[model samples]
Target: MSNGKKILIVEDDSAIAEIERDYLEIDGFEVQIVDNGPAGIERGASGEFNLILLDVMLPGADGFAVCRKLRETVDVPILMVTARQEDIDKIRGLGLGADDYIVKPFSPSELVARVKANLAQYERLRNRGGAPKDGSELKVGQIAIRPQSRRVYVRGEELTLKNKEYELLLFLVEHVDMVLSKETLYERIWGYDAIGDSATVAVHINRLRDKIEENPGDPKVIQTVWGAGYRFKA
Candidate 1:
């Protein structure tokens, strides 16, 4: 159903840009290439493409800046590419509103896979009628979630959440007051069996707490159940 979707590639390196464009085109995407961050920002603001493949290290402005600026204008999915493989960089990119990220020197196939996965997820969210039809907001005390817009608000202030963070939060909200194990949460939200790494749950929970809880160190909205998993409290 997503065949021939338009994708914009924003990369300063001509060779890398060409490779990405060729591979994306092969996968039935209409691809366009931009060599600088400013141009990419301009084109992105125009909302011409279904998706964007953005490079972190670009001439003029960096990828993070471009992502931030574009996010102010468009909700189109952005997949950030960078040579910096550090966890901080990945977190930073996601924090800046990128839907997903891939480190540079990555296999072309892997990049394409990420692109496909993101597009599929976006389409699912778009077509699933996830948002409210009446414009009535979903609230659990100070925490509010708008499924239609895929937005979370804490204490009336909108929280900036990445794709995975939003999904995890929504799952917790749907089952508020019920304890959900890490395994269950991962399998349900990730759509596969998990290895039961509580750390994965911990990171996302922490990220959510940073936005929803008054104090992440002493969380109240999403409370951790020792020896169990987590629960959302109204």
Candidate 2:
């Protein structure tokens, strides 16, 4: 039932990596394991896997660098694994293009759930076909959003966006000037059944600003409404 998807596990710890591989394989996914950061980057960029499970601490590059590098070449989903609980670390990981993150000491069930969720979401995007684009295409100033193709452009230059980042930007553009609360966006894009973390929304927003805005410190298109939420001022 997994649709024969391949997953890459990049972890320095053999035991942890084996555990994840076992669980994911049991769920019908093809899995590959690589230890440390350089190998992870090599396998990740090979285009052999549909998703990646990357650990934060590694011998060569660390999870952050792996995510950053992989993002530049690949558009697949990346889930960061780490023992750190600091918001800054999580934000940094998400900012670097990780689709989601799993804190260490987590249950195998939760691990599988996260992996499945990301894969499923990614599959939906891939299989969307020629299905109606809904908003189809949207243009706000120098930024252009093509929902059907899931592509974005700035001043005629195409920009790369992660799965959630594209979805967040599309949602904001669809709302168009309406203030969307963080909670509302979390539910709308991540779904009501999702893990429900507001920080996820914030991280994606920041990432979007970094890609589209001339000055990420002070954004123009995706604006914050103070305590209210975010708005896409067309």
Candidate 3:
């Protein structure tokens, strides 16, 4: 049912874009490519795609700018592709609402895996709209989440969360008080082995804390377990 999902590839390099498109199409995805940022954003805003594979450096607006703009208009998953592996770049990309990041020199297998994982997860979330079987809720302290509706409320006030942020929070909440290592969290949430570092998990953790924690600087709800990883305090 998930095959033939439409994906937009916003890469400036024709060769690289073609390679990505070819691989994804071979894996049963319907792929579209644009070589510049403005065109990417324009197509993205139309909500015609299930996901987007965006390159970092572009002609009209750079990937970060394109991501920020796209997030304003659409809720589809965005995965930023770049040659830069710096933590800052990854953090910035995730902060701009990208669902994942793939550094250059990545394997075509890994790329296909990422696209499939993201599209599947997005489909699951989009389809989960019915009420829970037992009217159960996932709650940690002042934060409450209804999995069926995909709604989150902190302190009785609903808070907006991007896709990965919601997934990360739900995972932590499910295993409340258990310290989960970055590697474990990455594998569980991303549905793939960590190809690089676990910086992606750390970025999403910080973003979630900022939204649900009383003080993001001194997070009380989601505590860092010092060398272990993060724990959601229940």
TM-score of each: 0.78, 0.85, 0.93
Model 2: lDDT equals: 0.85
Instruction: Output the lDDT of residue 111, model 1.
Output: 80
Q: Each candidate: how many clashes?
A: 1, 0, 0
Cα lDDT of model 2 by residue, 1-234, tens digit: 565899999998999999999999899899999898999999999998989999999998999999999999988889899999898999999888888888999999999888877777777666644325475567878878776777889989999777888778777877889999888887666653456777888989888898888899988888999999999988
Q: List ranges where model 3 is wrong by over 4 Å.
A: 127-131, 194-196
Superposed by TM-score, candidate 3 places the C-alpha of residue 72 at a distance from the truth, in angstroms, of 1.1
Candidate 2 has a TM-score of 0.85
Better of 1 and 3 by TM-score: 3
- Which one is best on lDDT? 3
CA lDDT scores, all candidates in order: 0.81, 0.85, 0.87
Error of 1 at 12 (Å): 1.2
| lDDT tens digits, residue span 52-76, model 3 | 9999999999999999999998998
RMSD of 2: 2.8
Off by over 4 Å in 2: 129-136, 140-142, 155-157, 191-194
